[model samples]
Target chain A: MSEPPARRRLGPALLAVGWLVLLLPPFYLSAFWLQTGLFAMAAVIAAIGLNLLVGTAGQLSLGHAFFLAVGAYGYTWLAGSPAADEGLSGLRLPPAVAFVAAVLLTGVAGALFSPVSGRLRAMYLGVATLALVFVGQHILLNATSVTGGFNGRSVPPLTVFGFVFGDTDDGLTVFDVPFGGLERLWYLGLLLVAVASLLARNLLRGRPGRALGALRDSETAAAVMGVHPARYRAAAFTVSSMYAGAAGALLALVFQRIVPDYFSLGLSMSFLAMVVIGGLGSVGGAAAGAVFVTVLPQLLGHFADRIPLVVAPGSTGTGLDASDAADFLYGAALVLTLVFAPDGLAGLLRRLRLPRPRLRAATPQTSAVGEPAVGDTLKEQTL
Target chain B: MSAGIDVPELRVHDVTVRFAGLTALDGVSFTVAPGSIHALVGPNGAGKSTTFNVLSGVYRVASGSVRFGDAELTALAPHRIAALGIARTFQNIVLTRGTVADNLMLGRHTLTRAGFLTSALRLPHVRGEQRAHRERVREIADFTGLGARFDTPVSLLSYGERKRVELARALCMEPKLLLLDEPVAGLNTAERAAMARTVASVRDALGLSVLIVEHDMGLVMRMSDEVTVLDFGRRISGGTPQQVQRDPAVIAAYLGGATDAPVGEETR
Candidate 1:
């Protein structure tokens, strides 16, 4: 069975638009918007990772920010130069090696927590991971030599070969626009997001994906079907943490400074809200959620005077600030999504009959482009 | 492929299970011969499910041993027991939270060599393995008369169809010893007959031993080569279906009170 003629053209048309947005951002957008887009990209990667763990594997993790801290600090410590005068110590390694190592280091940290994560389920796991934020905070504050204590530390610019992702000795210019840090980092962010998205999609559509889905539905059933619950959970957690690590490194590059206060329980909750608002278990949904969560605050700030009940950040008199306004909107969005649109924004788009790439057939007898009729069944099961 | 033809025997030796001062299984002893169907029939609370759980490694026995051809199964995990060529189906239908094809593929999880990394990377051999596994799943679905429902999520299927999906998944494991708990519990008359046919066909095609705990006396007597009767966690009688049906202890415990058969006459 083949798709209708109308839908046959829609897929490529939509894909071309998506690629155009990714490729043409730095050329037209200002530095502020470019930086905001970079932040959104980083968040998209982390949300996708968290979606796999919480959405797909049915494991709740509130320690996502702790892994992000691990990645940020790991990159700082490995890549930063040793400053004896400032009592700071680093390996002074190359930035590329440090980036890879930091991500792997976060995976190792996640593996270390497997003993706890594998044993706990649902709310218990969430509360247990919550403690990780506190533990991470304490370590970041006390480890002055590595983290520079509460003051945090500066991030070394990521350089590959002779090309630097910053304003350097010889900066390049394209279209009369100086290719500064944000412009160079935009391409880097784009590449990482692409790779991360590719990996997440492949994993979710494969054999391991089915095994995890079974384990989520029923542990006893999964065991009988030959899925080891503890092993799969641990593996999912590790991979998810590695994704967060990659995101954290990118975030650090964007910020150019890492601080202990940035990684907190609030940050973890925001990441959770991002995935829940996007639609759980879908990679594209998670990315959409991440973009919404990351860009909403900046958009609010840009039009702070015009939007009602929202005031500037520093001058607030009973009116919501930019960040607080974003939080309230997302909090309300989360509740509404859970109540009415349980599948979030992605589900809404799907309901509108927008054409989507059918990588795997959702129904056995349907062709590659058939719309899934299992939504009603899913609602009944969940209810 | 022929190596698995020598069906492994399962022997439960004086197995007793106690939970919080209550005896769930009391010195239960039974054996399933190679390539034969054995039935354990009992009342609703006669610990049939408990016995099935003990055999399938879901529960540990308080005393005695479970031997699957020389290897001890009492201490092994459920997945480990499954790896030892023993597979089971849940009484309440524990289906995967995905399509029937996906759930059936899970049955071949132990056989597939691809891990999360290989699958995520879409390695060459991973595609080959997935294709091979899907072919087997399709065959199993067809065998269980579930070919039309292959792409349908199991939650969307009817009760009888869901039961077939469960059985199909267990069969996909290519198990030497199949444990079915109350296989025809909620099925209608036609569904029950169809299920009996599928069970018989599966055993005949695979040449494997089957240990089934069922309450349908007609199906039990018709399908089983050997029958064991249980009453309040204790075995009342063990023999051929006709012998067990004729025994006074079995009659007094369950058959007499439940069925309308006379002492010396056959019911089914």
Candidate 2:
């Protein structure tokens, strides 16, 4: 059935307001908030990618952090100056080119794992990808020339057409406020998040999305409908990795440093939490989830001293540290989300907005005596 | 509505399929003439579904070949067989979680050519192609009496409507040959009658061959142009419904060796 005119109009108007809100944070927020916002945006991009794999294609990947690391390192190596005395090698390409190349590089890495990803189904593929984290960690720790060993290397600031994202001695002002590196990167992050979401939404609403969803439901049904399961599986993995790569690159830009310790199994788990918390197979859900998961810990840290039962990190207080408190809250949130709202935030929002229109529409068709009969028929049909 | 389509003959010759030590289908042979309704009927575990699986390339046969037109169906992958204008539905409803339009659009997967890149970019031609295919899908939905429920989720549909969704989905592929596995197995009497009428009209209107695996002998005898009876993975009888109905082997197979018991009693 066609949607009511009012409901149809509400979507675009809501989206415009959301975009306006997103665009305003950099102009007024403090550095801490901007940095947290940037991290959330990066997480949003990566979570969207992960959702495409785990949610849409029904493939499980615990190696998302590994791909993110690849993107971060790939960009750093591609754009960094070749410091011969320091024993670090780089292609020294332009940052913009390096950014695109890094994303493609991550895609190639994902493609390399396709033989494994394509053949293995959900949990099996997850276990298989678990190995990539360990392998990536080893390479990151031991590859001293590129990774700088225990001490991480500094990230080169991204420059697009000679305009540096790094802080300048005389910074450019926007709306009577000085836009430094964080502020500059804020816009970049916003642009990336917007583009990433648009592309993902387009993909999900199109032909590939339908095939992938069918594949998730039943491989035999998808096969008979002319969907190549393995091929689509591989494509999903590759595209997801590319998204992870872009996120990693943006994250490196935000952090201004790259550390091997950060790209651990825990990071991969965090990504999984974002997608699951957001809702599977939903682009908007993934973004909402990413924002929640990424921002929660930082928000806790920011207000740790004020919040009850939570102390600042490294304090000798007997209360829970901010990070530990964030972890506990995340676990509780995940459990509650799984138990109460299994469809995640997106589903919950949808449920809140649209109140069983189908049932309502059916009600007007029959008299009071026939209502139970219709309901019974519906119940029997559902069963 | 489906004019100018090249309906192809399906030839299955001595196809044998074995799962481990158990022979699921053993040397079963049949041919479905182009533009005809051919029903494969038998008792439970009579290798009817097994034969459909082999034809759809879900299971590999131990021996023999399945030829659809000039293509050897046995050698190709499931998607490749589908690409050769073959589509199918399962006995169990295997619809994805989405609206009817989404499931029907999946049937048009082979017909559309937008990959991840073009779809993500939403190229102008991609939108044009999607709109065009969606228009056709709507028409197919209307033809199958699902026009009203085109945007309705598959989960909300009645059992009978879901069966029709499956049929409509396969029809969306514009298949020259349609494979339906027990399309009306759990359907009520009225639903079964409607399904039978739709199945007949599909052949008449679309000029496509149908390979149907069903248990309802009444609908099978009434609708099918030819009936192939399978008993213990072997073809026990093959002919017109009337000829097969009176065949002693068919009657014995259905009534468990009671040659005197007419097969009409097994209609339910």
Q: List, in the given order, the native-contact fraction of each candidate.
A: 0.48, 0.60
Q: What is the TM-score of chain A alone in each candidate?
A: 0.90, 0.93
- Give the Å shift of residue A257 in candidate 1: 0.6
lDDT over C-alpha atoms for residue A245 of model 1: 97
Per-residue alpha-carbon lDDT of model 1 for B116-209, expressed as tens digits? 8898899999999999889988988887888877887564567777777788888889899999998887776777888898899888888999
Evaluated with lDDT, which candidate comes out highest?
Answer: 2
The DockQ values of the predictions, listed in order, are 0.39, 0.50
What's the lDDT for residue A36 in model 2? Answer: 95
Fnat of candidate 2: 0.60
Error (Å) of candidate 1 at residue A157 is 1.1
> lDDT for each of the candidates?
0.84, 0.88
Off by over 4 Å in 2: A356-383, B265-267
* The best candidate in terms of TM-score: 2
